[model samples]
Target chain A: MNALTTEKLTKAYSTKVALHDCTLAIPQGSVVALVGPNGAGKTTLLEIATGLVKATSGGATVLDGLEPGSLAALQRVAFVAQDAPLYQAISVGSLVHLAEALNPIFDRDFAIARLKEVEVPWKRRVGKLSGGQQAQVALTLAMARRPELLVLDEPTSGLDPLARQEFLAHLMNQVATSGMSVIFSSHSLAELERVADYLVLIVSGEIQIASPLEEIVAHHRVVVCAPGDLDGRHEIEVIDRQLDVRFGSHLVRTRNMETLRGLDSHATTLEEIVLGYLRRAQGIRVLEEIGRS
Target chain B: MDIDKDSLPTQQDHPSPISFGLDLRSGVPTYLQLVQQVEAALRLGHLQVGDRLPKVKDVVSSIAINPNTVLKAYRELEIRGITSGRPGVGTFIVVAPPTISTKAFDQLRSELVTGWLRDARGVGLEDDAIVALFHSALSESMYLANSEGSRSESDGDA
Candidate 1:
């Protein structure tokens, strides 16, 4: 079964559409990286899935077809929001205890042990802890539940590189042992490149790309061809293009290698593909404006 | 069940505590890095046939990477006929490592590569350009040889 599946998941805030008919299925056991530009509805999608906000239209489901934010689903799915919010006045020990009290299946020993492993002082108030430490505490609280699926929204944006690596390493260790699926949204493509086997890219409130990292990298190519060489290829879609007097640079999206024959082509990296998609989306908007004018 | 370390050959034959030794900052894809490291270890005589590889879970937990990445690396090795997975047991090395002897030949090969790279760099050729040239040359020769062999076979049939 998929860890999460969304069908036509849509959301709007007054006049602005946060997510538009977003349909995606994230397979179980995948460490997926969810990425997009600012205001591309990444937070909205997560919020809708977690049931923080009601979707304008359509819906999403978590582990084993449980509706997001439902009682049973909440027990199986853990979400650490971007802020990693915790009660400021509560001591770290109290917070851990609170998690145990709230969740019937919470692992008390694991929580304490993880905190100790990270050297987070149990007596210190959450407000007094460093951002990284507090994030760790938050993660421990969520992980202590031993959920089947974990959703993190920009969980490491506030962390230093070392802290981020440690956090990811700990999460991966857990995943390896338990076979839990993780979906985390982050702006750090480099970190994602290392940890994420699957990638989900959102653009302009839409699902731009969602596939395994290897497949995505394999299907896209940066081919430098002559200006008129790609004219008749209806099967190929150019995601981004740059033209010079000497060469026509096109980021072509296709799995067929035969079409790219004799062209100076190279496989594209994740960052390059993401940037190309974003650039292409912006270019389309510009073209739409020109058409309207 | 995990592979029994005690049942394996001695340390001189196969290195204990097998590792991918991945360079996360090197910008190579993680799975490819894992594959290359395994091949490199085999080539260096650090891993031998009949040696048990680390379990996927162990690599994932130790390296803090997705299990699929390790699986992909292992799958690549399996496709290349270097390793095979045993049901209910861990993956095992099945193929013998290619023997590399004569230190003088190794040094000579490295010297030639270094000198060729220096000349290429002197000509303002980038690493990518050098790789592309080498790859094209290799592919062209292989393609020509395959076609020629096929033609000779057809002639014999006729």
Candidate 2:
């Protein structure tokens, strides 16, 4: 069963549409990376999936066909929103107690043990803790619930490089031991490349690419050749192109390797692939606006 | 001069004989780097036939990489018959790669230094160019050997 699925999930405010007819299904046991430019519906999609926000149209389901925000879904899905909002005024110990009182599934011992292991001062106020410590507290509380799926929104946005590595290492360790599924949205492509097996690319409130990371890497190639060399090749879909006086480098998606014969084509990193798609999406939006005008 | 055996480190305290290191900037796939590291260790006699690989959880905690990458590398090693996984136990190296004798190693090193290195420098190749040339040649020959071996095996099967 899929961990989460959205069908025609659309959300619109008074002035702008956040998500538009977005359909995606994240398989069970996948560490999915949701990436897009700011205001590209990443947060909107995540909020809808976590049942924190109501979709203007369509719906999202989690954990084997349970509707988001339903009691059952809430029990099985834990979400750490952007910035990991918690009761800053309370001490870490109090926060733990509060969480235990609110959620029956919350494991007090587990939370305490994990916090101690990370050297988070439980006696200190949550507001007094460092950003990394607060994030760890939030993550520990979420994991203490032992939910089937964990959703994170920009979990590493404000963290330093070392902090981010430690945070992800802790998360990956839990996943290795517990087999809990994860879906997170972040702008850190390199970090995501290390931890995510599935990739979802969103642009302008629309889903552009959703596939396994390996498939994306295998199908996309960065080909460096003269400008005239690609004149007759229609089989390759050029996602982004950079041209100089002597050479043209094309980021293309093509299944037939033979089409790139006699050209210097190499595998593309996730960063390159995401940047290429984002640039192409921007170009398309510009063209559409021009056509409309 | 009394030494307490109980204070000394024990094998149980350090279960894994080998630890993994990752180079994210190497441009090679994460799993392949791990496999190559194990192969290199085996060839250098640093890892023996019975050496135990680290647990997936331990590796993930240390390296911050997806556990699937470690699992994939171990699976690849298993496929190559270099390691075997015992359900509740740990993955252990099953086959030791053939090691070059010290005399042969020394001879090969001297030949490379005197012949290939001298010839490349004589041709005015810089250090970077020489290194690049060496890697490309190595990969090309490995690729050729792999393809030709598979082709002949298929022919024999037919």
Candidate 3:
């Protein structure tokens, strides 16, 4: 069963639409990476899935078809927001105690042990700690709940390279031992390249691609050829193209390598794929603005 | 006092002999990278038959990759009949990969250095160009082999 599934999910605000008919399924036991340009509704989708925000139409379900924000779903799913909001005034020790007092399943021992391992000062105020330490403390609390599915919104945004590696290593170790699923949104494509197996690309509040990372990397090829070389290729699905006076580099998705046999093609990195799609989306927006004007 | 130290029970639990490193710039999938490392270790005699592979947790902690990727690599190795998992014990190298004899290895190396290296250098190919040309030739050969349908592993596509 899918850990999380949304069908025709839409969230529209008075000013702008956040998500439009967004439908996707995150399989159980897979580490999914949700990526998009800033304000592309990644946060909205995550908020809706974690029950923090209500959808305007359609719905989402988590863990055995439980409705998001329901008591059961809340118990089984843990979320860490982008900022990892914590009580700045409270000590780490106090926060741990508070979490234990509030949640029946909170594993205080595990949280304490983890915090100690990460060298987080239990006596210091949460606000006084470094950004990395705060993030770790937040993750420790969430993990101590032993939730079936952990959803994180840009957990490594402000972390240094070492801290980010340590955080993800800790997370992967937990996944190895506990077999819990994860869905995290990150702007760092290189970071996601190693840990994330599932990929979800959102553009302009719509889902552009959702598939296994392996499939996406395998199917997408970047071909640099003369301009107009790909004009009539019906089999190649051109995702994005950049043209220069000398050459045109086309990012095309095709399952058959035979189609690109004679082309100067190479494999694309995850960052390239994400940027290509985002560029295409921005181009479309520009064209729409031009037409309207 | 002729006790066999090699047969002692205490010697069996040594940590895994090999650790994995990743080259993300290589564009190889993470799991495939793990698989290739194991294969390379086996080929170089660094990992021997019956040697235990690292635990999934250990690999994940060191490499900072998903544990599932490690598991997938071990699974692929098992599928290839190169390794086998012993449930609670750990995965072990089951078969020794085919190795070239020392004589043939030396001869092949000498031939490459004398023949291909000389020709490339004679044409004013620099170090980077020589390496790039070698890799491109290797890839072309692999591609031809793939088209001939002799390579059984699907990892070549990646």
**Stretches of model 2 off by over 4 angstroms after superposition:** A243-246, A286-293, B1-12, B98-158
In candidate 2 chain A, where is summed lDDT lowest over 10 consecutive residues? Answer: A255-264
Clashing pairs in 3: none
Q: Candidate 2, residues A98-209: lDDT per residue as tens digits? A: 9899897998888999999999998999999999999999999999999899999999998989889999999999999888899999999999999999999999899989
For DockQ, the strongest prediction is 3
True contacts kept of each: 0.52, 0.73, 0.73
Model 2 C-alpha lDDT versus the unseen true structure:
0.88
Ranking by lDDT: 3, 2, 1
lDDT of 1 by residue, B1-158 (tens): 23575565543454444776667566578888888887878887888887778877667656767777888888988898989988645688899645467897898799868897788889999989999887876755654464466456557767
User: Which residue pairs clash within candidate 2?
Assistant: none
In the range A1-293, model 3's lDDT, one tens digit per residue, is 89889999999999999999988888899899999999999999999989999999998999869999889998989999997899999999999999999887998889999999999998999999999999999999999999999999999998999999999999999999998999999999999888999999998899999998877877787887876777776668999887455687889997666666656677779889988998999999999999999
Could you give candidate 2's per-residue lDDT for residues B1-158 as a string of tens digits? 23655664444775876788888787788999999999999988888888888888889998999989889999999998899988756788999755679999999999999999999999999999999888767755654464466456557767
Q: Which of 1 and 3 is the better model by lDDT? A: 3
